[model samples]
Target: MSDGVKVIAVNRKARHDYAVDETYECGIELLGTEVKSFRDGKISFPDSWAEVINGEVWLRSLRIAENPFSSIFNHDPDRRKKLLLHRDEIKRIARKVDEKGYTLIPLSFYFKKGRVKVELGLCKGKKAYDKRADIRERDIQREVSREFRAKLH
Candidate 1:
């Protein structure tokens, strides 16, 4: 089977604010109208995250705008969604999250093989100095690329 991946939304701030140590791709429980909203690219996840609750993982703060055609049947825009993960995987994630400074964050959302999938990141919050250093490194990389291009021409 061909693996077709179509990205729906990405939380760009998550990477800048947290240092991701590992990532997991899992399916999310979504409503029909929510899926339609995704197809329309009407999704926004601000300050969104995931947490292991009662042996299950749930995504919180994800906002999928209601589909115009769904009227009364449209899903709630701010409802938390369940993330489908294996029992063993959830247990492992819970253990890791219990460690100090580690937390779960949603990195991106996409459609894989016609089904919605979530990319969850196991991350540690970055300090202010860390963010500054990242910006410095990015600037240096940009300059280096510019100089390399100039030399080639």
Candidate 2:
């Protein structure tokens, strides 16, 4: 939410299904049409994920819809895009992901300083009970806020 950062898309399902432990800001490689589609917020990443492959991170399942204005050079909507990250950082993330129950997923996509950036989250899968607990907690908080508002008025 800093200056010059414009969020394009967020994967809400990812946050609900997994517990995010850490996040990394990474640059994404994109074609011209893909960038245009992002500017218009025509992207979906419900089931997208990131993986460290051969010492590099690749994002899979991110769909950038075609721009109607673009001609025959449009990029594939489901192309696997490469992520740009420091070598040491990639190694560190790869190490953590190799552990049990840990995985990498894309949290959000945004434009930073006129360039596209991706937010990658290091996450662990949550259990059914855990999700239920989160929902219950949220409801309790909402009730508390409502009661406080009514008391003030």
Candidate 3:
């Protein structure tokens, strides 16, 4: 977190579906109009994920909505944006991805010093029982907090 950073969108489903192990801050290659759209909060990462291809990380299924004012030079809303990451970082992440059940997921997007950045998470999909356990743990925590608040009042 810094002075000029502003969060644009977050993929809540990522947290619900995956057990995030590590995070990476990476840059996104965006068109001029796409930046405008992002600033206006017209972006989504519903079915989106990242992949390492040819030693580069590519963001797939990130939808930046079309800017209405930018008529002809608008970028495609469904383009696979390229991610800017260091060579060693990409290789490390790629190796982790090659593991049996690991994948890359975009957790959130934001602006850092006027440049858009994506928070990429190294995650593994959760089993049904894992998800249920998470839900149960959350419920127990909520009840404990509620009881503490009641005693304080």
Question: What's each prediction's clash count?
Answer: 0, 0, 0
The sequence of per-residue lDDT tens digits that candidate 1 reaches over residues 8-89 is 8888999999999999999999999999998999988869899999999999988899998987998889999999999999
Cα RMSD of all models vs. native, in order, equals 1.7, 1.1, 0.9
lDDT of each: 0.92, 0.93, 0.94
State residue 107's C-alpha deviation in candidate 1, in Å.
Answer: 0.6
User: Between prediction 1 and prediction 3, which has the larger lDDT?
Assistant: 3
Q: List the pairs of residues colliding in candidate 2.
A: none
Q: List the candidates' TM-scores in order.
A: 0.95, 0.95, 0.97
Model 2 weakest lDDT span, ten residues long: 94-103
Residue 61 in model 2: lDDT: 88
lDDT tens readout by residue for model 3, 9-125? 989999999999999999999999999999999998888999989999999999899999988998899989999999999999999899766889999999999899999999999
lDDT of 1 at 9: 81
lDDT of 2 by residue, 1-153 (tens): 899998888889999999999999999999999999999999988888989999999999889999998889888999899999999999999999986658899999999999999999999999999999999999999999999999999
Per-residue lDDT, model 3, residue 70, is 89
Task: List the candidate 1 regions with Cα displacement exceeding 4 Å.
Answer: 1-3
